[model samples]
Target: MNAKRKNKILTWIATISFGVISLIALFPIISLVISSLRPSSELMRQGISFSINFSQLSLDNYLYIFNQAPEYWAWYGNSLVISAITIVLSLFFSSMVGYALAVYDFKGKNFFFLLVLLILMVPFEILMLPLYQLMINTQLIDTYFAVVLPMVVAPVAVFFFRQYALGLPIQLMDAARIDGSTEYGIFFKIMLPLMGPSLAAMAILQGLGSWNNFLWPLLVLRSNDMFTLPIGLATLLTPYGNNYDVLIAGSVLTIIPIIILFVFFQRYFIAGLTTGGVKG
Candidate 1:
């Protein structure tokens, strides 16, 4: 075959392969959606199966979630507020730390970076007890601050931002400084706009982590009103009875925010990942 024809054939094959992989990846989500539409009794009797009982499927679960579940909305709000704050604070603090590490010279910089790396290597499970104790000492339990504080300086975010920032030209900052711009001014006005892609990428990641975070919130948040989505959903299951109807429906609704988030940031996601991977 000619080179052009060979390349075209390969492209077709790659497209088909990717389409299949995409469908396979979407199977669980598809199943969840279908399960959510099914009656709870049906789910209990049949479990999850390919068999579609369209006749029995209805909007009862969704209605119950929307109309009857006040706690669900409270939990949803808590998750939203916590994740929003976490995203903003994480981006602010992590980016600043990462930016400084990328561009500035200071004492203990290497040591601090090394500490971040070491912390990243350690599992959160190992630190949970101590972190819980610290929270108790500070009396931050059952508060949103307890959930938001621990993750605000995410090590992974710092590392990624640092890698992306290292590739940014320092000449701009020098020029800005010469023009009477303070360090904060240069960063906020110049460097931040340039770091859009990395910022978007980290925002999505950090938002997702905070939204779905169950363990830390579970440990800290004692009241029902303070519970996040994951913990609130968990409360539906008990030794006596399980509220599968609301659980499945709530789970389906939980996906909507994340989908909106990805849609908003998707334009920059790939670009940010590529720059961070290549430069960092």
Candidate 2:
């Protein structure tokens, strides 16, 4: 075959492959959304089946979720607060550390970078017992701080920022220094402004992780009132029975913030991922 015909065939194959992948990825979400709209009676009858009834849309499940399940609201609020704080604190500390690593050459710089790499390889599950014990000793259990503090120094975020910062020009810093800007001023004023895309991307990732955290929060939080969304959602699954509609509604609620954030900052998130993926 001629080269142009081969290329055309390859392009069509790639397009079809992407469409299939997109459908596979979207199927579960589409199912959940359709189920969320169906009446509880229909859902109970369907029971994991993929049957669809366009005429069965009802707001009762959502209304019950908000009005009847007060704990869901509390969990939602706790999750939101902790996740927001985690994102802010993580971004601030990670950016500072990443900036120092990226922009400066100091004694033990290589050692510290190696240490970060080493830490990154260690799983959080391995440290869970020790982290819980530390939290107990510090008397931070059952508090929002317990959830917020552990996640604030995210190694992943640090690595992401460090890599992103590598692409920035040293001349910019030199110019700022020559203009009598302090190191802190240069970082906060110049480096940070240029790092918006990276920061936004890290914030979205860290925020989602914090919001969905279950095991650590369940371990530290003893009271129902302090439970985040995931913990509270777990409570819905008792041995006695389960409310599928309410559960679906709760899951939908949990995802709404992430969807909104992605919609708002998708450009930056994509740029940040591209930047990190393409370089050190």
Per lDDT, the best of the predicted structures is: 1
lDDT of each: 0.88, 0.83
Residue-level lDDT tens digits of model 1 in 31-95? 98899999987887777898888998888999999999999999999999999999999999999
Give per-residue CA lDDT, model 2, range 61-163, as digits (tens).
Answer: 8988978988888888999899889989999999899878898989998888888778878988889999999999999999999988878888777888888
**Ten contiguous residues with the weakest lDDT in model 2:** 271-280
lDDT of predicted model 2: 0.83
Q: What TM-score would every model get versus the actual structure?
A: 0.87, 0.87
